[model samples]
Target: MKRKEKFENRKTVRKTECRRSRNLGSCPAAEVSKLQKTVNSFAYTLEKAHFLDYVQYASNEKRIFRRAFLTGLLRGFGTAVGVTVLGAVIIYLFQALAKSNLPYIADFISDIIDIIEKTRK
Candidate 1:
């Protein structure tokens, strides 16, 4: 009966105990301390189970979606612009090389284009 009383009372909140009795000197203090520790640990764990709440605590769905979409669209746009600039540079180089005094340079460029076309096949 005493053990059941003690167990029920153990889970309830109370102040730090310092009571003393025969055959149980300092034992109540230990029991109270252990119960308090368990309570504290449970409270701490309860505070952390809100995973989704923590993630969406300060974020709006529309804002996140807008940022992601704009980022991807801008990335794709920049890549297309970069490829166009690179192709222009290559064409300009080929035109300059064709007008040069070296006669074999044009043949070399044509051969390279042929090789590229063959690879596509």
Candidate 2:
């Protein structure tokens, strides 16, 4: 009979232990600490992630691209300047020739007018 009583007491203790464990899930302290640890770990990893490395890599790529862009722009500008200088020289030579050949001025003017009219048409 005493052995049966001991077994019943042990069963009661086991039942209470199971109920306590289930209630722990609803406990405020346990829930708060669980959430706190998760938040802390997320914040730590976020702080550790490197952003400067990405910025430096982007800046280096931009610098290389910008350098190439500037080089191409300067080359195009130089070619345009050379063409303009050649055109100016040609125009100056023709003007000089026209001054010395007064009779040709009328023909030159007629040719200029025809080119303008053709381009307009």
Predict model 1's lDDT versus the native.
0.72
TM-score of each: 0.42, 0.35
User: Could you give candidate 1's per-residue lDDT for residues 5-94 as a string of tens digits?
Assistant: 997787553322433333445455667678679999987886788756756854788878888899999999999999999987986787
Residue range with the least summed lDDT across 10 consecutive positions in model 1 = 13-22
Best by TM-score: 1
After superposition, the stretches of candidate 2 with alpha carbons farther than 4 Å from their true spots are 1-60, 102-121
Model 1: residues >4 Å from true position, as ranges? 1-58, 110-121
lDDT for each candidate structure = 0.72, 0.74
Clashes (candidate 1): 0
